[model samples]
Target: MPRRWLMAALLALVPAGAGATPVNAYPDIARAYWVEIDGRPAWAGNADQAMPVASLAKLMAALVLDEEADLAGTVTVSRAASAATGTRLGVRAGETYLASDLFSAMLVRSANDVCRALADWHGGGDDDTFVARMNARAAELGMVSTRFANACGHDAPGQGSSARDLALLARAVMARPRIMEDARRESFAFASLDGRRFSVRSTNALLGQFPGAIGLKTGFTPGAGRCLVALAERDGHEVLAILLHAPDRWWDTVGLLELAFDQARRNAPPE
Candidate 1:
């Protein structure tokens, strides 16, 4: 199936009235919300409360890789990287790719293999080094509530951040033109040293579903329920919407971003 058509069909299945509920409406489900419109923090609920970030940590991991190594440089894969699981781009050991290609896979596909490969290549051949860089970057970014124990945000305890901190990180990542482009990519293909080709699709449903929605990240674990940092732009204004540990997680996010866009449009000054 064509990937865009598949996503469009999935979106058609979701009712247009999904966002009609009130902003705070949910059936006995606890949620954390933070919204920033046109460069200001305009709305928040439990924004400072800490929560597990899951794979959203990949942004930092990719940033660290960009800093420590040349994105245009080639990276040789190792066994450790090939072994990573969950939402992968199916990279094999002994294959080589430009660091920028792998970084694209890391951000757009949220591929564990690409992330592991970046960790191995740039972090002195160990994920611990990659994690340390994430921690240091978090501190440098003033993300005091964040502590990354791994490059990919798997369900390890103590690996998490608050809505506020993640928002800050989102803003930072958004500022990077390259990373932002990668994040917004719906699909891309990467070629290996052996001429084998692999492609991946974005995991953030909102990318293709919601109009004007762009890139960010998504994560899930039995412990984390479902978490997402979703972004959308309309009429020259960008809004960042976040939800942590919410039921009907996908719909919750879709609803939130839609509401945010609507609110922004309503509040937008005369052109």
Candidate 2:
């Protein structure tokens, strides 16, 4: 049988309506996928394919910030940062914001300006250096299929990563206390050096909508389509779902999490 038909057959086992979780019903539109259950690989489909990941790459920026940069200091926004497009924070050149605040903007709001601002600050006013650090860190983490060309995850020709590599990065991000806390919150608030107040809300919609949903990140571009790295914890079991170009990410993630936990439960020895 064809793959789509097989998937459909598998999904037919799920009951409709109340308490039904569609297992193996991932959308055909998804380009690459990976899921980890309790820190172990549970599913994979073309998870090593290098493709544009859009704002998901900003997770690396957050990782880099946590490892190398001074997160508590103040960073001045440069023209390069102020000029960032595709998700703006309305920051202007010559403005100064807390490095911690900018980091919050990058994760919570997916603000490209903060990505650039933080990178520039870390690189001593040079983004290239920061990108080099990102690549190096990815390599150190065994992300062989990943590369970063820019601080913000813009669609550049050479900028691409695989789902598996991103999963590894996500594990590292979750290990850090600050990064995990930032991901869990819906919004981060702070005042600028100029004393203007600003609040940035996270782009991850699953927080309030889905039970046990914590965070990760979301990415999209004309080329990347809808991408998401979702983390959900229930009954002390954690599941991480990574989907690239998935048109129905929120639903798929929920289903995938349900299936993972169910499978794990079935495999457990009787007490």
Candidate 3:
């Protein structure tokens, strides 16, 4: 009798065999995925289908700059680069910066102007050439679901990427030793071409809010509401989380991360 009751209680705790949380429970998100450091797919829903990434696309822009430009090289900011819309680094025409500085700005601050400047300064020869190279790099990286029409991740009607493609790209960026360091920075400063100092703060609200929340990026537009690709580290394990088309991106992202960490802990071997 006691043994039968124990079995029932244990079964009750099993939670229907660990399926994903209900969609209505998280109504704001269109799709998401949480990936372990070992490249294991832990949780996913609507991960393979392509969707608007908004400013999260800037992650690719930063990676492309990291690969193609010498971080120490100087770039003279063009009028076109400085005049870009949305969030900016407040750079002016004729301003110049070390390529790495712009890369930092692009990743840490999601600076639209810095992205354009970096693309123009080192993307083959011109803006068009640089955008082409970005797309080519995406293909080479097996981001078949991704298409880059601009360096700053502007709201182009057709430009988008799947959660799988983003996972691949995030893996590629995280693989580089320097990128982790760059993304983890909370703030950065640099001098423009005119020698004026510029300092930028990160847009990822969870950086210091949640435990082990590293840096990624945050984005939105009317067409794409509240997007994020965030990384967190706990107990020597790293997990990447991506959320798209979310309305309450801040709390939703935090909730997903907490759930992922909880799941990881439950699955971990006893210490």
Candidate 4:
């Protein structure tokens, strides 16, 4: 049992089995994993390793924009924004767009270009300044193992965060209804100022397919493999599951949720 969880430590006093599933039983191939049961730490695996988090770093962008930047303001796409590659919105430089739309582009579409656009706009100058603020926010949130090198979570030399740190981020994000609303969508259509149209589908596979799954996010890279921060609400209870560098995140998340919820129910004292 992970000693960091006081609940787990107390539960250890019971007979060995305690109707709990061992953390090792789940097929967690990710570099790290963490599960929160009713907003409490419950289980973890390699939860402290700072590994390439792919687009998961975009969570910081979402935070920065929500807390500091004006989403209603228009953003002028910069040369750097237009040049961003991989899972991008393909926005053009010199095009003007609403900051909120660009935000949707980043969260709903995981569009790299929009992320860069927001970073540039919110940084008040450059991405480094934005990333510096990201680091500061992480520290403010007490995410000691996390760091950011860029707004979009491409594999940068110093860009990395741990599953434990991400769990903190997930909680902070979920508390913001606006951010949750954006992450909860399945797809959205966005049009630039010049009437150019674009459609995007969410990379998060659980929203509709999984019962009770709500707003959260997903990530991928050759280095990060598959990363996901998923939240679900059932019977007025919420569960969060985090996976980093896992190939089968869909199944892994499902299995972890089922196992964790079952344990929670088993421990509940007769309703």
Candidate 5:
């Protein structure tokens, strides 16, 4: 099916007044944002505007890896991966590590090195191949407004994602129990085949501080600014909020989640 037709079909299913963009609800919230309560859009702003999303792109890479790669398999780091910029696990070239370990660090710490390594491994020594797979998967997921330039979320021309597109991506990630399990963790400990110990903590600050906060992802870049995909559950209600280029993501996410849950309660069918 055509991507636009797929998106239109998806939008048509939203309940009346369910997915309206209310810019006034939260001023200066972000460049683009979207919030959903149990898969139902509650509020949004610039939801379809394509913009830099930083490491949030990793979510899509992680999704592609989960579907195509074996977690139990091992991967050897490449020079390109070892030299990756931004946040990284500091993995040296030629080091061998479990794909699962690299996956954990990539998601939790936003480690660029390990992310690149995994991408190289999955691409059979070519990151571009992996990126092509990411783009193909994005289209399949109805993320028409997204594009991937690299395995690690790096700033590059022609690489961007929209708030709504990321919401769709996040939903796919949430469906994977293993990925969610790793994402929610406060920290992860692992070692390479040569016995190099490494410890990494979750970049998602909400894990311990926010009520019912669980596994999600965070990102930042000079171009992308601070981005976040926050998921929280309370009383069987799940709230997922995506913020791109948010200046105050921590506070904004908390407020958005609270509002989403409240809205969910208010809109509940009368008992």
Candidate 6:
């Protein structure tokens, strides 16, 4: 069966009104949002509306790289990668680093430079090929509302994703232990083959402040505003929240996570 049809069929199995919340439950929190508790939908608003997601697109890039590239391999920074805009590790063209280090930098720091280098390496010096792979992977993972225009999550025409689609993508990312390990990191440090060192801290503010927060990813752009995919586990219950174009993502995410956990507890079967 075609991937889209399979995805549609799977989505049909979710019960209507399963923990549905009013679209305006949290007014002005974000342009689009979705929350899930223990793998079931909990609340949503404009969840299917596609919008620019900025660095959150890195999650999908990480996924595609993990599936196809060898982390242990080395990648030399290309001129295009070294010239990438946005958050970067300042790697110079021709510098070589382990693919794993680049992967960590991409997730932990949202470093566009390393992300581009990884993509370029995976595409045999052509990041566009890697982006095509990313789009294909998005389709295979049932991210029907998601598309990749670049490996580093730059804002571009036709590059967008919905909160619902991001939730699906996040689930796929969480299933990969290596990727999650990187996501959970608060900071990463590494050196290139030339012995030039670099360090980067995670952009996810909730990592140290929010109890039980295990990361997911964060994003921002002039066009996308602020975006986040937050995952937290407490008392054997897990809550996953996605926010797109949020003005106050940190505060909004914390409230949503707490609400989801509370609902899970209230709905839990008695001991």
Winner by lDDT: 6
Candidate 4 residue-wise lDDT, 1-271, digit = tens:
3332334334423321332432433333467888777777666678888998999899888997898888989999999999998899789999988888899879998999989989998887598899999999999999988888888999878889998899989988887888988999999887888888888999998989988898698999888889999898876667788899987888767766765666666555675
Instruction: List runs of model 3 lying over 4 Å from the truth.
Output: 1-28, 31-38
Note the Cα lDDT for every prediction shown.
0.75, 0.82, 0.73, 0.82, 0.86, 0.87
Better of 4 and 6 by lDDT: 6
Q: Write the per-residue lDDT of candidate 6 for residues 1-271, one digit (tens) a residue.
A: 4453344334433432455653435545689988788887866789889899999999999999898889999999999999999998899999999999999999999999999999999999898899999999999989888888988889999899999999989999999999999998998899998899987889999998899999989999998999999999999999898999998888767766876677677777899
Candidate 6 matches the true fold with a TM-score of: 0.91
Estimate the TM-score of every prediction.
Answer: 0.85, 0.89, 0.86, 0.90, 0.91, 0.91
What is the model-wide C-alpha lDDT for candidate 1? 0.75
Candidate 4, superposed: residue stretches over 4 Å from native: 1-27
- Model 6 scores what on Cα lDDT? 0.87
Candidate closer to the true structure by TM-score (higher is better), 2 or 6: 6
lDDT per residue (tens digit) for residues 88-173 in model 2: 78887888888988888788889888789889999999999999999999999999999999978899989999988999999999
| Model 2 misplacement above 4 A | 1-29
What tens-digit string does per-residue lDDT give for candidate 5 at 169-267? 999998898789888999999999999999988999999999999969999999999999999999778888889899889976876787677666766
Positional deviation of residue 137's Cα in model 4 after best superposition, in angstroms: 0.5
Instruction: Choose 4 or 5, whichever is better by lDDT.
Output: 5
Return whichever of 3 and 5 wins on lDDT. 5
| lDDT (tens digit, per residue) of candidate 3 on 1-271 | 3453334334323221234332222323455543443245555557666777878888787777777668888888888988999888788888767887788878888888888888888865488788788788889999988887777778886688877788888888887766777788888888876679988888888887889987677887666667888899988766687777776777766666665566566666798
Output the lDDT of residue 213, model 2.
88
Residue pairs in collision within model 1: none
Window of ten residues with lowest summed lDDT in model 1? 14-23
lDDT of 2: 0.82
